[model samples]
Target chain A: MMGQTAPMREAAKHAILILGALIVIIPFYVMVSYSLKSPREIESNTGGFFGAQAPMVDEYCVKVGNPKEDCLETPVIFNYSQAIKKAPLFRYLLNGVIVTASIFLLQVLIALPCAYALSKLRFWGREFVFSLVMFCLLIPVHAIALPIYIMLAKIGLTNTYASLVIPWTISVFGIFLMRQFFMTVPDDLIDAARMDGMSEFSIVWKVMLPTAIPALLAFAIFSVVAHWNDYFWPRIVITGDRDLYTPPLGLREFQGDADGSMWGPMMATATIIVTPLLVVFMLAQRRFIEGITLTGMK
Target chain B: MAVSSKNTGFWFVAPAVSLMFLLLIAPVLVAAFLSFTDYSLGNQGFSWVGLENYIKMFSRSTYSKMISASVTYVLLVVPLSIGLGLGAALLINSVRHFGDFYKTIYFLPVMAALLAMAIVWEFTLHPTIGLVNETLADGCGAWTETVFSFGWIPGIDGGQSWYSKGCQDSFPLWFGDKSYSMGTVAFIGIWQAFGFNMVLYLAGLTSVPRELYQAAEMDGAYRAWDRFRLVTWPMLGPTTVFVVTITTIRSFQVFDTVEAITHGGPSKSTYVMMYAIYEKGIQQNLMGIGSAITLVFLVFVLLLTLVQRYFVERKVHYA
Candidate 1:
């Protein structure tokens, strides 16, 4: 009886979880499938998962005075091509990489030293600075975006890439994450580096960095995933500048232009914007989960 | 060459400290000050409007709707997502196989961009051609409709049921209809957020000692529910506190979905706080009113976190 009930319980749990999994995966399925189908298929909701691979005419291309034959292409090609061409999705992808990479690099640059100072080296006002960081952690940057935008506008920096990156450079959370990580490092390691006549800066980069790779890698994933998907700050600052649009913002531009007929291209744009992070997450699932849940450590 | 390590510490932290002051602290102060005045971006000089924006916020119907919408969304998303998250974690923890597969699938939404997902949801909830409606349409005159609409009960009017109504007429526009808009948006919020909470709870679950469960079992906790109540629930207290606080805060900042899909619309049903701030402050350039909303938002957040801290100190923390 116990063995029978155990299998039954396991089966029930699996059933519930599979249902949840299906609901969770529905949007992704729709996103990828619609991106593969034609406008007619998308509107009327025909075609299977990979679509029929049927040829479709680019109505806009023919409208631009191109021959109908020249405009003819497969649904998948048309969707993806229109996604790239209609919007600067490639440029948006580049901007996403640039912004996320710069934000992460600048965060590490500013945070590692401060984290070391807060955790390892003792100095005057250290407690005050740490308390300040604690207080600032309570300040969600999104909540105070208006004033920051105003400040950026006053400095004539709105719509530049700097506006997108500057406000994020001071990641109090990064300092907190690294500081927590640095607390685990042995004091003897820093002492040995000091005895070897390495400068404090060099010790931070060369000594502390190598050991903090796991924590840093986790933080890197967290930061990149965040700023890459971040739409609000970019939306607020990068108004009117197509060149500075991030992936999310670019997807939004596609959404704005989406008539009922534009679903394929829009979904294609969404797939383009959402794919990189999802791919990375799949490749490094454990690290990605750890990075995302890094906040739970507090 | 001769600089002391003690002094080097300040130099190391100086950049971060100043930037923190400049970026985080100063903006908050600016917001607080600006909330009391009629300030715009390019205006020369403006007079202080003492509590005018706040007055309008409290008295006006639109701002009241904004408050209700935000509060409703927070109230809806936080507990539901956290509940779903804890449930998933418990089930996965109890199961022997395929736990990793479920965890990965659940966490996929957290990985994808919210704006993109929101847009996809817009399509999925489209009135005529959406997957959700299409799937429901396929269920017309079937057991699904009968069972779901409660036609099985004697004397119950299944034809007047929501499922039947949807089958007869077109289904409600999930985003376009005001009644369904907030729920649909909150559903997306829960979809995106629960996986994050699930992962957090999974971490918390792994740390609960095996001995405690054994002790409970040894003490004659024969049923699974009994064991869970005595051991698991108490063990997950700290994680619950943290998860609730974080989820509440994130729910308050739900901009991407509202801004992308609903535009705080179908009569402001999804007019969440973050979207309100963006619309009032950035788009309309009504700096004073926007700053006023920002201040109100910061106050709610700070109060919530303070309460969470109080709870953690008083009750939740076991270690």
Candidate 2:
């Protein structure tokens, strides 16, 4: 009896899952669609998926005293070019790369050594320091945003790029994850390095770092995706300095006073901001999923 | 173990220890200390008002509403997202085809920046020209309207149904209406969040031993629900706990959607605690009350985490 109804049950499950998937895809569809659409299409809610590639006049361009022919361009070109022209989007993407890269590299520098010590090296007060790590993991850094912002403000470090990157330099979860991974490394490998006259510090860089690449790659994905997508810290620290804005902060600034005519460019900006990570994730779905779900393993 | 290597650990851990102290430990202590005094930026002096800010938090309606809004958000987002996540996970796990396709689509939200997606969602939910209303309005006087209106059931007059009423006039201004703002923000929150939880639950589902299911079958658990209750839920114990704790914390820190979409508006109906901290502490520079709220927020988080820890110890057992 169960076998008889199994196909029907499975089809029902698929139907339900399809409905949920459609809901998930709506905003993404809107974002990409709006990016390709003319302002009229957006306001009227017309253009089916991609707007008609109609060569519409950009009133803003015309209002700037340009030629009518010069202002005449397709909505796709107008939206994307206006997005770049309206804001230094390239600079924001560059800052995003620099910040996420620096944070990840610095995290590895700090976490790898500490995790190595905790997992491999025998030292005084090791257990206690490890306990401190466990405790700090419970303290969400965002919760402490009030005090940190106050401290940064008092030191007049609020507007600097340093302020954005400094607070996230020490990642306790990174330390914990690396430590767990390091514990599984055979002690014979470290002893072998020591026998080969490599110093402990050299061993960390030369031997341990190379072997920990897979874990490091996973951690890199986790860290970069997080900081890249992070809006909260950058919002607080990079106040009013449009030059220092990360991608999300830049998008927020773009939308701050955006009127109706700017929807096309605004979503173009969003699509630009969201595209890099989405592209990377698509290219490496397995690694990205494994890297992100690494949190769940803890 | 080499006793000579003992010195390496201290030097190895030094930078991380110092950083952890300066960045993590110090801010928490600073938040605690600042909660008692009226401090502001560029102010030379501060006078301690012991428990005054805390008193204000408990006594004031605004702060009270902030607490309720946050609790309501967590109460709504946590369970719904987790249930949706678990359901999606179970369904996707059981299905034989297109599993990866659905997984990728669901996780798109988790990868995209929340602020950007929230903006897109704002556009999608716009009152007049938005896709939501446009699509809903299309169903008016159509078969979807009658069926969705529940007009077929006896005594279920079509006029009284929300679907019918929406068809009659319009849907609520999703993020603009006071009654609906919190729900809409929570909906966006769930949209961005459940995918992560689903991925986590999917990971958990994989670790459930196949032999246990076979054993359950041997025990005459022929029905799907019976097999699931016997095998799946118990094996997913640790994942469920972790998912709940993480989702709760994530839900508590929900500021991007509020900041971008609502700005805690519709008469502060969506005034969550994180936004409250930002409004008071940073923007308004009311450091005392902000710190007080921050402290209260920390206490709630730590308490929730502690409860999860306790429950995990007592209830979650691996057989």
Candidate 3:
């Protein structure tokens, strides 16, 4: 009897989970499907999920006074090509890469040494510095946007890449995470490097960094995913500068000027903006989960 | 092996210390100092206005809306996301097959760019010709309309059935309706957030020992729920606290959805604090009021986190 009921219980669990999975995937389904469909099909909600792969005339192409025949193309081709061309999307994506990369690199360059110092070295005022990091952890960057923006404006730095990357460069969370990680590095490894005439800096780079790769990888994933998806800060600082737009800002810009006919390319843009991280996440599910949930680590 | 002569630690930490001071600490101080003044970017010199901004914040209806909207969002999203996350984690934990598959599917929301997904959800939730309305219209003929309707109960009439009513009339203009705007934004926030919480809870669940279950079973906890109560609940105490604190903080910081989708629309029902700060400070350049909101936001976060730390230190030190 118990054995019989076990399958039923499993089936019940499957039922609930399947419902949730459907809700979650509905947007992704719409995103990918709309990216493939023509605007007419999207507006009419017809032609099925994959659409008919029908030849659709590019209205914008004709609006630009191209020959009507020259404008005729498949919806898929039009959607993706226009997605790239409608804005400097490639530039936006490249800027996304540049900003996220520079921020992570600077965070590491500042944080690793500081974290190592806090965790490994016996120094006066070390406790004070660590306490400061703990206190700064409470200050979410978004909350203090007013003063930060004012300060940046005073320095003549708004609408610049430095504005996008500078405030986040000092991530106390990274400092804290790395310090916690560094504390676990066996003392003997550092002592051995010291005995071999390695300076503390050299030991930090040569010994501790290599040992902390997993933790560092986790931090890297955390930082990259965050800044890549961050819209609030970029939206504030990158105003009027299309060249400095991140993916989210680029998408927002596309939407702000868009007409009804732009849905296909707009979704294609959305998919393009969202795909890189999504694909990476799907591929490295365990690592991504571990990285994100690293906060839960004691 | 003692090399205290150079104090290399000072050199290593100085840059980070100074940057932290400038970026993090100074902003809080600046916001507090500027909150009492009419400081704008171009104006340079400004006159002090003691308690004026705070008075406006308390007196203004718009600020009240902001406070209510933010509190409502946090109250709703925080609990619901944590509940769903814990539920999903528990369900996935007990399942023998396709656990990783469910996990991958659920975690997709967390991984996707929220702004992009919000746009997609905006499309799907579009009032006309969107997937939600279309799907609801499809359900008009099917038993789905009947099953969901509570009209079968004698006291509840067909008019009382939201599902049937929606099927009869049009479904809601979800993000456009004031009554539904904050709820809809909160829903999107939940959709994005619970996945992260689920992943965290999954990690926490894995750390729970098998021996505890055996011990509970030996203690006459024969039923699944019994063992869960006797073992799992106590074991998960720490995870629960951490999840609650982290989710609360993240929910407090919710801006992308409200900014992109609602813009505090449908009568400012979604005027969250972050958006308020952005609108007042960045867009309109009201540095005084903006800094006031920012200081309040900072204090709320600081107090909440301090409370969380106190709880961690004094309250939930589990076995």
lDDT by residue for model 3 (A117-192), tens: 9998878789999999998888898888888888898899999999999999998999999999888888998888
| Residue-level lDDT tens digits of model 1 in A1-298 | 8987999989999999999999999999999999999888887777889888889888888999999999889999888888988998899999999999999999999999999999998888999999999999999999999999999999999999899999999999999999999999999989989999999999999999999999899889889888888988999999898999999998988888779778888899999889888898989898888877775566
TM-score of 3: 0.98
Return whichever of 1 and 2 wins on lDDT.
2
What's the lDDT for residue A157 in model 2? Answer: 95
DockQ order, best first, reads 2, 3, 1
lDDT of 1 by residue, B83-134 (tens): 9999999999889999999999999998889999999998898888999999
Superposition TM-score, candidate 2 onto the true structure? 0.98
Native-to-model Cα distance after best TM-score fit, residue A255 in candidate 1, in Å: 1.2
Backbone clashes, candidate 2: 0
Residue-level lDDT tens digits of model 2 in A1-298: 8798889988998999899999999999999999999999998888788998799998988999999999899999999998999999999999999999999889999999999999999899999999999999989999899889988888899988889899999999999999999999999999999999899999999989998988899899889988999999998888888889999999999998689989999999999999999999999999999988985568
Per prediction, the TM-score for chain B is 0.97, 0.97, 0.96
Q: What share of the true interface contacts does each candidate keep?
A: 0.88, 0.90, 0.80
**Candidate 2's residue-wise lDDT over B42-118, tens digit each?**
89999999999999999999998999999999999999999999999999999989999999999999999999999
lDDT-based ranking: 2, 1, 3
Candidate 2 off by > 4 Å? none
In lDDT terms, which candidate is top? 2
